[model samples]
Target chain A: MLEYVLSKYNFWTYAILLIIGLYAMVGKKNLVKKLIGMNIFQSAVILFYISIGVKKGGATVPIFLGDAHAAHGHEIIIDAAHYFIPLPHVLMLTAIVVSVATTGVALAVLILIYKRYKTLEMDEIMKIRQDTGA
Target chain B: MIWQLDVIFCLFVIICAIAAINVKDLLAAVIILGAYSFFMCILWTEMGAVDVAFTEASVGAGVGTVLFIAAVNKTKRRSKD
Candidate 1:
């Protein structure tokens, strides 16, 4: 059991991070802290995806470095084992961009919420809404 | 990729994540979150995801932190809870 847990420690770390992020999102009363949690959650997911592409024992980034014309003149054998899987990296790149955009939009909405409610606390915002009968 | 570096980066990332969420000051939390993103970037690079690490460094640590600080400046920095 100890060896099994130690072998895949990356996954375990990410799981802990995911749990922390989830707890912050659900348990935190501050609006910005919830956003921070959301960011952490997104990062953990990205890390998981990137980790999935990792290859052990002399694997490298997925970039074709050989000359295309030289390969055309002579048959060049490509070994899949030599390079890391790039699909997850590409996908995570897109995910990171989307996460940033989402953060920007969420922050804008948070600013508007603060402007309207005059406070960033969730309970205070709820009370203000209740008092105003909105 | 050195597993030792990976483990160190992971440890730092987790610490920063916890600190970011637990801090009462919004700006400080945002900055700690930036540090978390930086550690994550380093971990990605150590894992041989150079492009992803670059993107994370720029987008997650750079732009994200700036936006959060801007929002914090525009709003209140204190947290009751």
Candidate 2:
């Protein structure tokens, strides 16, 4: 039990974060709160992917630490044991930028919604739309 | 893994995230969320993801927070629930 718990503690931590974010996104009344919840959800996913790339006992950055010009075809072999996963890092980099962009767009939309309805509450907006037949 | 630092930082991240959502004030929530992002960046750095940490610091903690603050300024401060 101890070994199992120790080995999977990181996953448990992230799971808690995911649950918190999901609750905020699904249960919150404010539109901005939903946006913040989206941020948390994205961050949790990014962190999980990044953690998946980590290895035990031995790890190195994915970049070629040695001479590039003197490289040979025979030395192109990938030693998976020591090399870090550059793929997830690059993918998550793209994801982070995309998340920022999407958040900006979402916030802009929020501004428009607030301006039109004079409130940011989801229920209030829904009621307003119903009343206005919009 | 350095259990001490990792445990502490992870705990801080969780606390910040929870506080960010639970606080009634939207601006305070945004600030707390920014702090959460900073803690997450540091945690990623400790995990040896320097590039991810850099991106998180610049985009997530820096620009993202500023954008949130701007949105909050434009919207109502109090939440219905």
Candidate 3:
């Protein structure tokens, strides 16, 4: 049991992090806290994808080392196993951009909510809404 | 990848994530979140994802923290819960 658990500790850590993020999103009463939870959740997901692309052997980044023109006289052999997978990284680049964009838009909406409601707490906002019947 | 360093960085990341959400002060929480992002970048670099690390450093730690701080400044800093 110990060996199995120790070997896959990274997955365990990510799972714990995901749970924390989810708890914050659901249990937190403040809007900013919920936003922080969302960010944490997104990070955990990106981490999971990056971890998935990792290999257990001698592997480097997926980038060409030598120039193609310099090796024109001889055929260059590329080994797939020698490098980390690039697909997850490429997909995560877009995810990171989307995360930031979501953050910015959420913050803007938060500011607007604060402006109208004069508070950022969920309960307070609900109270105001019910009082105003809106 | 160094498993020891990975474990250490993961510990810090988890701590930062918990602290960031639990802190009552909005500004402090935002700063802690930045620290979390920075630790995450380091972790990614250790895991052999250099490009992801760079992007996380620039965007997550840099711009995200700034946006959160600005929003906190414009609004209330104290969280009731």
- Top TM-score model: 3
Candidate 3 error regions (>4 Å): A72-75
Better of 1 and 2 by DockQ: 1
Q: TM-score of each model's B chain?
A: 0.95, 0.95, 0.96
- Clash pairs for candidate 3: none
State, as a TM-score between 0 and 1, how close model 1 is to the true structure: 0.96
What would the per-residue lDDT of candidate 2 be over residues B1-81, giving only the tens digit for each residue? 586788788889889889988999999999999999999998888777889889999999999999999999998999866
Q: Which ten residues in a row have the lowest lDDT in candidate 3 chain A?
A: A60-69
lDDT tens readout by residue for model 3, B1-81: 888888888999999999988999989999999999999999888877889899999998899999999999999999987
lDDT of 3 by residue, A1-134 (tens): 98897798779889988999999999999999999999999999999999998887888887877897888899889888888899999899889988999999999999999999999999999999999999
Which digits, one per residue and each the tens of the lDDT, describe model 2 over residues A76-127?
7657887677788899999999999999999999999888999999898899
Which whole-number lDDT from 0 to 100 does residue B80 have in model 3? Answer: 82
Off by over 4 Å in 1: A72-74
Provide the lowest-lDDT 10-residue window in model 2 chain B.
B1-10
The candidate scoring highest on DockQ is: 1
Report how far residue B21 has shifted in candidate 1, in Å.
0.5
Give the DockQ of candidate 3.
0.85
> Model 2 compared with the native: what TM-score?
0.92
